[model samples]
Target: MSALTLAAPAPPASAPPPRQLRWLLRLHRPALYAWTGLVVVLGALLLWLGGPLTDASEAAWKQYNACGMAACTYDQDAILLYKDVARYTGSAVLALPFLVAAWAGASLIGRELETGTAQLAWTQGVTPTRWLVAKLALPAALVTAGTSLLALLHHLAWSAGRGRVDNTEPWYSIETLYAGGPVLVALALAGLAAGALLGLLLRRSLAALIGSALVTGVLWIGTFLTLPHLWPAVTRVSSLRDGPSGSGITVAEGLLTADGDRLAIPRYCGSSIDPACGSLFDRLDAVSFYRDYHPRSHSGPLLLVATGILLAVAVLLTVVAFRVLRHRTADRKGAAV
Candidate 1:
């Protein structure tokens, strides 16, 4: 009783720290909904493509093939539907990176910075460093998870149609291959990083949005130009009669000399089975036609190498984003502390 009387009232318990993540979720709720909706729609379409659509298209192809050079009756509607769905979905999947970059730059970082929301947060419980971390870490995880899911589903859907639907894209087809692999996931991550960095640098929403998308576009173009060269192309030599034999992505098809010199095909010269072509080949000392190509077996290596390059660029951009944030915050006179 005496101790209780003598003791000073304990200091009021400090208010519980604000949940930064709760605010983050609240702030980005619309984006979250939009992303969820997009994933759901795409996922549903992919499942349909892999199952019913594929089956229907395959059946139609069988009927058409069986009729052979005669007036044929088949489910032409199913085939056209399959093609349209596949084309649209594949295009959507491939376009995701640039779309993500645009949104990330315009809404995620640029708007926050441009509107003073980020600076306001820095004065509260959240430091500039912590704010940046919160902004990037969650979005990065979500983007990676979502993009990876789409890619896996796409690959499976594409695989289901292979050998079944004659019109299905080959494995090396750029849109099909990129949309249906881990490379898409890596590219998405890089786009996120690019958007964040560009938003921070420009500090203007529209400018950052355009800049990010352009950067991502450039990244993709570079990957396209660099992919085939990343892995060594196998040399498939066929006698000049067969006209350059390998089956997957063709890098180069040219005449090979007896001394092993690779020569470009002269104008109008193709298969040596052509009398004119054979005559020209014999005169040029061409002993065979050699095709430098990446077969189906090389798909794994090409995907892995391209993915690695994109990931490296993403990491570099992320580090720079953090550094830039720190420097900017440091100049704000302890506002971030």
Candidate 2:
């Protein structure tokens, strides 16, 4: 019977496929919950800002104003929520990355290291490289998705509000700055990268949190101060209108030109070329002066530089994290022997 059993073929041991370390990486619930709550709150706040709670007041919006001999008719209508709220809301949303950075950076990798749980995790089939990659992947995905959704919502809500009301509000004024596609994405990624680097560098939960806050604060101040200087060509001036002599002297009565080239007619009013040689008519070609003028005030170039710098920092810190993980794992293994 034993000989017969020995003659039977042994069962082949099956090799396991490579485990996806990503499955093990998960957001800490408290942090995830807080971030989700913040997102919901921001969305609700934006909706409230865009919605009309009350119509324009009859008292504040009079049908006509009695001022001297000039009877100014209040032909203007009620203000729309979009014009009043959109740009400001979008700008406020732009600031969300700071909060996201502070919260995310604080907890990112530091929490794992602090709890000693990551050490246990490394002993599994997962390599440190796979584990680190997994740690970064999920949070990066979440931040990207959140930022995209925010941008889309802003675009839809603001587009609906365009031209409905006077967009002269400070909120509306900043929309162009906040609404650029690349700027928004870069801001989000910058926050994430900053947070990840902080977490990796500190290796302590609270330290990571504080470090993120400090970095975010510094970035905000720096961006506010310097970004405008990086791309200045975007600012525009109104164009002057040329017309017949009947309306020729009307200064503010005319409309701005299509390309926004406000003329220096005031300076040319009494110049040598004027109809009256005594009346100087030096028509300064403002367009010619401004045409070749290239300004680098917009935030894009600075943002790119900042992004590259932060990305490099994040990579370096990540490398350090990998080394720390590997070294710790080797130490543990050597001790076990």
Best by lDDT: 1
Model 1: worst 10 consecutive residues (lDDT sum): 9-18
The C-alpha TM-scores of every prediction are 0.92, 0.57
lDDT of each: 0.89, 0.53
> RMSD for each model, in Å, please?
4.3, 10.1
Which prediction has the highest TM-score against the true structure? 1
Give per-residue CA lDDT, model 2, range 1-337, as digits (tens): 8899789664322321245353454446566677677667767755554444112312213333333467665534443434346545667677776766776666666777778656656655556556666777776777777766676666555544444333433221345445433445556666666676677667788888788777766765565555444443332332222321221112122222336554444434323334642222223322311121123233446556655554555556556656766676677679999
Candidate 1 local lDDT, 247-304, one digit each (tens):
8888888888999999998887778778998889989999988889999999999999
Residue 87 displacement (Å), model 2:
7.9
Model 2 clash count equals 16
